[model samples]
Target: MSALWTIFRRDLTLLLFGAPGRGGALLPLLFFLAVAMLYPFAVGPDAKLLARTGAGVIWVAALLAAILPLDRLVEPDLEAGFFDQWALRGIAEEGVLSLRILAHWLSFGVPLMLAAPLAAGLLNLDGAQLWTVELGLLLGTPGLAAIGVTIAALTAGLRAGAALGGLLAIPLAVPLLIFGAGSLQPGGEGGLLLLAASSLAALAIAPFAAGGAIRAGRE
Candidate 1:
């Protein structure tokens, strides 16, 4: 229990504050905001158009933002032998990975939600649209986080793993994107339920999948 707490705290700090070569939490937030800011200009100043497309744009931005930290999520620690050390101490990779999913979500998911209001304004989303977008992000980002960690673990030992991880994550994330954006439409509340289910499913599978990948990497 104590070791798990320590691992969680360490991961949270590294993910939130970043290390010398890593971009940390700030990078994703900036990228997400940049997408929001540039989108208005790219699509012109038609308020209705912005409002109409803004929620989907936000969902896309959040998805991309979730991708930014994938390279650092598992590879760094794996390279540094932390996984081995934890194994020596009888720690299960699944438990560590589950905590890492939570930590990853905290590092980017929560921040995206917090920043959604600003993004909403930039994209000309009304209050009701903003609310739905926020709700969608809440239910969907965990799935993004889970997918991110799973990809990170799967590619941790590969050449150009980061690029490959991003490529893999996009297709896998389409379900979340579909449901997340779908939730913004009128009579689309069912999308939220689907989104939540997707997120929970990812959460359930990520730890075991990532753990197996890590174990395979060790052999």
Candidate 2:
């Protein structure tokens, strides 16, 4: 319990309270906010058009925005030899990884998810559809965060990590994005059910997979 809180608070402080001056963190959050706003600008100015594109725009932006921070996900620990130190501490590596992921999700995922409703307004979502978009995103984004952290962890120690992280994550995330975005279609309630299920499943499975990947990297 204490360890979990310790890791969570440490990452949360870095993610939410860090000075904007730091390049290792905080920059990606700013990017998230900026990308979320671009949809209404590039798509169209009309409210209907904006609403039409709003869910997808915000969804895609949120995915991309959160992912941007993932590149540094484990690179710092690996570079600083903190990974080695942790491994030597007789701690279960999975707990460390899970707590770190939870922290990262809290710092990155929770905020973006919270901000989605407001971004929906920017996208001009109708009141009714706004609720739908919120439902879809809320249920679907944990899957995204899980898959993202898994893939990011896989690629974080590699050379050309940014490009490789994109390569690995883009394909995996497509399904969630599809059904999640599809949920916004008129009479598209089917996709919402699937996306919601996917979210739960991913939450169940992806963390273990991410833990496996992290453990494998150390071997």
Candidate 3:
């Protein structure tokens, strides 16, 4: 537990606060809000419409927001040779990626879930649907992080890699979003359960792929 927190704090501080001028701090948060806000405008001002759409809107926004930071993840650390030092610590690179992703989820995904109320308000989501949205996010965001991390590592070198990461992520994540968004609809609890199952499955599989990608990036 202490080791986990240490890794979490170290990765978080390095990515966010540890930078010289606080460069990346606001980018993730603003990206989150902006993506959430787009729904009402795009779908019109009808409350019912917003409520129905809000769940999907927020889920997609959360996903995009969650993914945005991943592009920068290994770039700086790899450039500075953190992985070289990390490699000698008797821990596999996958273990390192797992720690970092968990911390990133805590810093990024948890707040996205916490701020879901803003999306609810904007979209006028009812109580049950709001709960559905929340539950879906609770389960789904970790999947998003796991999958997003893998894709981020894969695209670490290309110029448009970050954008491509998001693109690749969308297809892989479509099912989660479908179930997550559907969960907010009437009689959609089944979908949330499916979403939870899906997320768990993703978590199980994604790390190995991400670990492989990270190793390739290192070499």
Candidate 4:
């Protein structure tokens, strides 16, 4: 229990503070804001259009933001011999990866949720839309985080793994995007339920998938 707590704290620190060649929590948040800030200019600042389409845009931006840290997630620890050390100490890959998932969600998902309101304002979303958007994100970002880590694990040792990770994560994330953005529409609360289902599915599978990848990489 103590060891797990320690690893979780360590993983959280690495995810938040970041090591060399890895992005910390701030980069994704900034990237998310940048996309939101730029969309208005790209679409000519039409308020009604922005309000109508903005939730979807936020969903896209959030998806992209979630991708930003993929490269940093697993490779750094793999390269630094941390995973090896954990193995030597009898720690299971699943345990480490599970902790990592929690840390990643904290660093990635929570902050994005925190910044959603600002994003809502930038896109001129109304109160109801903002509430739905936040709710959608609350349910969906965990799936995004899970998918990101799973893809990161799968592509960790590859050349241009970050790019590959993004490619891999995007398609898998379509369900979340669909449901998350869908939730902002009129009579779209059902999307939130579907989004939660997707999140639970991802969270359930990620640890095992990522653990397998890490274990396979050991050979």
* Clash count list over all predictions: 0, 0, 0, 0
Which regions of candidate 3 fall more than 4 Å away from where they truly are?
1-5, 15-25
In order, the Cα lDDT scores of the candidates are 0.96, 0.72, 0.76, 0.92
Worst 10 residues of 4 by lDDT: 14-23
- Model 4 lDDT, residue 13, Cα: 89
lDDT of candidate 1 over 41-101, digit per residue (tens):
9989899999999999999999999999999999989999999999999999999999999
Model 1 TM-score on a 0 to 1 scale? 0.99
Kindly list the per-residue Cα lDDT of model 4 for residues 77-181, writing each as its tens digit: 898898899899999988888888889999989999899999999999998898898888888998998998899999998999988899999999999999999
Better of 1 and 3 by TM-score: 1
Model 2 off-target regions past 4 Å? 19-29
lDDT of 1 at 88: 95
Give the Cα error of residue 50 in candidate 1, in Å.
0.5
Best by lDDT: 1
Q: Candidates sorted by lDDT, descending order?
A: 1, 4, 3, 2
Question: Residue 135's C-alpha lDDT in candidate 2?
Answer: 81
Q: What would the TM-scores of all predictions be?
A: 0.99, 0.86, 0.88, 0.97
CA lDDT for candidate 3: 0.76
Instruction: Quote the lDDT for 13 in model 2.
Output: 71
* Candidate 3 residue 142 C-alpha distance from true site, Å: 0.5
Positional deviation of residue 5's Cα in model 1 after best superposition, in angstroms: 0.1
